[model samples]
Target: MRGVSADGDAGLGIDLLDAIEALKSVGCAVQAVITDGVATSIREDRRARGLPRAEWVRGIASQIALARRESPNRGGRHLGFAQALVHEMPHTLAMLRTGRLNEWRATLLVRETACLSAADRGIVDRRLCSDPAILDGVGDRGLIARAKALAVELDAAAVVARHRKAVSERRVTTRPAPDSMAYLSVLMPVEQAVCLQATLGRDADSLIATGDSCGRTRNQLMVDLLFDRGTGASVASGVPVAVNLVLSDETLLAGGHEAAQLQGLGPIPAAIARQLVADAVDNDTETSLQRVYSCPQSGALTAMESQARTFPKSLRQLIDLRDRTCRTPWCDAPIRHHDHIRLRRESGATTADNGSGLCEACNYAKEAPGWTARPVHNPGRTHLIDVRTPTG
Candidate 1:
């Protein structure tokens, strides 16, 4: 039995070099696929087998994410996790190629690249192509240099942003979804909302419920008002101004403003904005024709009322202390309003333990669900802030 000669060909002619060559070929083909775009599914079953383009791309983004520790087989992370990264590209290539990112940010981009699959690289490239931060901050030349540097380091395994990853981060930038209804909704409802609305306007509508609160936000419409006011508020003692008039190229030139966008507030000039303010003040207009059709939804309306009202006496002191800042670490959002971890309508106690301070951004994340302020232990003992990474 010991002499059965179990090995094939008595271990005679296995070409190890040939096997290595084959692997190199396979890697090359895969690299091409990653660098180029993939056609959308022409057949449904094809879609079923592989991850959807979005999901596939997202899965490959693992490179950008922190590699798990104490896992089974980890050694500086083999390239097994992500696909598109083999090509060293991102959804926002043009921006990345421009040196818009700082050193810390370059590493962050590398991590993002780790998550994309070969098929998803095209998608990522397009998404990031025109990112203003990449172009403006990192600059095209800088991004290209960084991209080249990263290619050597990561083999195009991850994205490179214009800023450092350590500068600030969000939860929803890369993940699939975000959690909402946490903070601001629980506190200063109506008037603050009104002020925010007046200050930000249409852009507020586009804030994704559970995503990051930065980037070229859909809130440009909202910010434009602030920009207009920022440039000229001194003339009116910082009171909210109103503007009413048809905006045209001529008007834009007259007001020292230009085109801008985010998710909302399409476009209007500073001069026109000021003119509208003057018109509103002169007429004592509470609502414009558009306003009649643009009233807050029942949910926002109710929220506005509750927020405008005050923090219950029992909760005031608690809110004042725990939330000295926005409660979202690194965010300096003022605690203008007190919010309950759990809202009143949900039968939450109107007690000190139920309160904390939050700025508008965090408020949106929690307000909908009405956070659990206290029960087993108070919400503030955590002395925590809401900080998460972005998914999309």
Candidate 2:
């Protein structure tokens, strides 16, 4: 593998293709192991506890998540894919095992056939994957379109039902982006999403035609219009929203070069923070400042304590500021739950030191058996948590 990098371009291309095929084989082997493990565990649980299948499967995904070093949501999806390939889609699995189809393409096949019955799904899988050469030139979209068409032909009613269920799952979400920007995404029905985009474009075009766009490009004007309409703030005027900007006294008062943290987003330049504050003031927007003192050396916020079991709003905010995101290692999801590092039933006090910010899924996954989290002391000005998973 290392020598492949030193090869000529033609040789390198061949080596790369071989490497990818090898990876696909490895992925297929891993899926087989996961499927076997799940089956074995379920059988053992049923025999030992005489429990229902649903009860036996509880917390299994959490164990898989720990073993795979992924979030529980991803673990569940993996488990589902493994089951589908092992039991229902044998043709697709065979193609994957032989490296004719990669894991992602196999997953797409499964997803597109999700609305079909087992028999119907098998037919689609066989039609699409039985001859490995048939998929040689097929792209992702082409494979998905073929599988979807087959699924619809097999069971149009099931496809319509799946669409209805998917519509119910539509939601809006946000994620941090590069350069202190953030991506705001909406998952809506296709027609509604298209109409919203068309509306924004039409308005932006009208503004451009009227020469009132203040030299902004059409795309820029469309984005600005979205912001103004969403927040009820005029673009020509300052923003009226209450944005939390966490900065040091040195940065805010003495022109220090340190970056400022924006809540729900990440860090921004100190200059931009100051300009935002100045704009708010100039526009006479109502603004209030609450002092948050941190250690000069370590930059850790001062600890706050409470006797109540539930964390107070102020303490929750402090934890949010301290952690910035989910505390689970490798999971950068935004904090949706203020979790107790130590359980309250075990005498964990509602104090800043014992509090941690976590995403909702991670918080729930931690409640499974054999998962433990505790605060550990560190000499540096940073909060340290020791988490032990069942596999560990």
Candidate 3:
């Protein structure tokens, strides 16, 4: 979308998005060069996050430099994570200025657009991820804006989840300034926080605030979660495995440095762990699973889709408005993904109106009768509110 010669010369700023889109039209590689070049030159800086947009430009520039060397057709060789970084450019710049969005959210945007391969990863890093004008040409402007907003909300929850975990683990560090030590808050909808604690095997902290600074690190935070919640005497019914889960929860929940360990999950030992979860089965908690299984989504292969009559979109939006921290109504764990109610292949209409989001355990607990079957009162939209007073 920048400077291209009247003689059909390559534009300086176009990236693969421009190149590939044009290739579909012109059927030429040179045009790909022209378009791709124009896409990579300009970059935007998101100042609030302290990340400069120039890094993108530099990344793309590196690709251009490489192409000028070995691959004149501009093929082969990856730009490493730098190219992978291309997916996040727009949101990163937007987030730096707002502080409302973060890195993981920004990266989702970058990767979503990275389906094209005309530009090398190196080039993508420089051209598409770097340039300011690239976002202008993105299709479905409304969709892009809406998706970004959703990602921001999700990231905020993750941040809070991490913070609370940190406090529970004693990972927080402290240093006094003139007035006070710089404190961090893990803000969450009380319901979500409550659910996360249960998933981690802790009891509850209905009204958690910014505790000491030592709760910042991940390992410490998770350990603290276990210690704080399970500090009291162990009951006779409690199994050692349950206590171990408490330990694991603490180890996993602590945020910041130790988070990677939690995320890098290895194979589950099928013996005791599986038996524990399997034996845990008899209690039944399918409310959350069934709710999610009943929802809809974008990945559908069908003909006669769910067409809303009265309201264009279905009034029941499960994802937008969660009913509980636990899908089973009383079980625990923050929702991770949707468990389609109607099977995707059964010609089920793909819409949020058809399903709900749920955690894995509750979602898979269909062995018990009525496990996945819940009494969804009203079956449609009606405002539900609690009479409880605010704690936070």
Pick the lDDT winner: 2
- Candidate 2 stretches with Cα past 4 Å from truth are 35-43, 50-55
User: Which of the two, 1 or 2, has more lDDT?
Assistant: 2
TM-score of each: 0.25, 0.92, 0.19
User: Any runs in candidate 1 off by more than 4 Å, and if so which?
Assistant: 1-309, 312-318, 328-332, 368-392
Which is the winner by lDDT between candidate 2 and candidate 3? 2
Ranking of candidates on TM-score, top first? 2, 1, 3
In candidate 1 the C-alpha lDDT for residue 176 amounts to 15
Best by TM-score: 2
Candidate 1 has an lDDT of: 0.39
TM-score of 2: 0.92
Please give the RMSD to the true structure for each candidate, in Å: 22.7, 2.3, 22.6
Task: Please tell me which model should have the higher lDDT, number 1 or number 3.
Answer: 1
Per-residue C-alpha lDDT of model 2 across residues 1-392, encoded as one tens digit per residue: 56556256887788788877868676775776576577567658655876665555655665666667777677777787888888899888887777777888988988998888889999998888889888889899998888888888999999999999999999988888887778999999999999999999999999999999999999999999998998888875877766788998888889999999998888999998888888888888887788987876789898899998888999999998988988887667889999889999988879988999998878887875557889887745688889987557
Q: How do these models rank on lDDT, best leading?
A: 2, 1, 3
Collision count for each candidate, in order: 79, 0, 56
Report the C-alpha lDDT of model 3 over 196-220, residue by residue, as the tens digit: 6575433223223344334345434
